[model samples]
Every structure is written in C-alpha cells, then in structure tokens.
Target: MTSEKKTYNFLIAGVPYKLKTSHDDATVEELVEFVNSRMNQALGVTKNGSYQNAAVLTAMNLAEELILLKRKAHRELEKLEEKALQLSMDLENSKSNKVLNN
Candidate 1:
C-alpha cells in the first residue's frame, strides 16, 4: 500500500530541519535526538571544529558503528550455521547407529 510522506520538523545541533518521511512523529524525534547527541559528541572532541566538520565526523562515527555491527552479525550468523550443520550430522549419526543395533 502506498502511504503519503509527512513532514517532520526537528532541530539538530541547534539548526532546524524538515524531513519528509513515512516514519511516525516519535521515531523522527528519536532520530533527531540521536543526531544531535552524535554531533555534540563530535564537537566535544574537536573543540574548535565547525558545525559542518562536526556533522561530517558524526556521520563517519555512525558509519563505523554500523559497519562493526554488521560484521558482528555476520560472524554470529556463521556460528549459528555451523552449529546447525553439526546438529544435523549428529542426528544422522544417531539414526544410523540405532538402525545398526536393531
């Protein structure tokens, strides 16, 4: 189903922004808060940095966090796949052993 995008007005790093998104009001507000927090942290680290620089740094930091999370998730999925394979092999061996003893 197609839904109309709604305008969400928010402030980040003291600057006002308007976004057209399908997200609910609360989700937009939460994202705005996250962006502001990231930018503030960037500014804190680079005391003399401009707003643009802080914003860029914040983006880089968030990207890094996303990449690390993706990597961790991939590793976990690999582990689960290996465990499943092992369980399948164990089940097959048990079935064969039961037939041999019968």
Candidate 2:
C-alpha cells in the first residue's frame, strides 16, 4: 500500500528545507539527522571548510558508502543464490537416490 506524500520541514547544518516525500516522519527525521551528521563530519576534517565544500564532501562520502554497500549486498545475494542452487541440486539427487534404492 502506498501512503500519501507528506510535507516535512527539516534543518541540516542550520539550513532549513521543506520536502515532500512518501516516507514517514521518523524516517524523514532520521535522514535529516544523518545528513547533518555527515556534513559536520566533513567540515571537521577539512581545512578551511566552507558549507559548499562540506556539502560536496558529504555527497562524495555518501556516494562512496552507497557504492560499497551495494557491492556488498550484491556479493551476498550471489552467495545466497549459489547456496540455494546447491541445496536444490542436493535435494534432487537425494530424491533420485531414494527412487533407485526402492
């Protein structure tokens, strides 16, 4: 079931934004907090960090993280698929052996 879009007002790095999203309030709040935290983390590490620099750094960091996570998930899915196929083959072999014995 799809929920109606909601208008949420949130602040990140002291800047306010109004967004229309299908996500629930808690999710929106959590996302806002995470972005703020990332921005702060970038600012803290960079020398002479402006908001623009921090924003770009945060975006890059998030992109790298997303790519890494996607790669990990894909590898995990491949392993799961391989295991499922092996299990299916084992079951088929077991059935064949049972019929041969009978």
Best by TM-score: 2
lDDT of each: 0.90, 0.92
lDDT of 1 by residue, 6-56 (tens): 988778888889899887778888888899999989988886878988988
Model 1 TM-score, all chains together? 0.90
Q: Pick the candidate with the highest lDDT.
A: 2
**What is the clash count for each candidate, in the order shown?**
0, 0
Encode model 2's per-residue lDDT on 41-86: one tens digit a residue.
9889888978899999999999999999999999999999999999
Judge candidate 1 at residue 38 and give its lDDT.
95
Provide TM-scores for the models.
0.90, 0.92
Model 1 scores a C-alpha lDDT of 0.90
Error of 2 at 60 (Å): 1.0
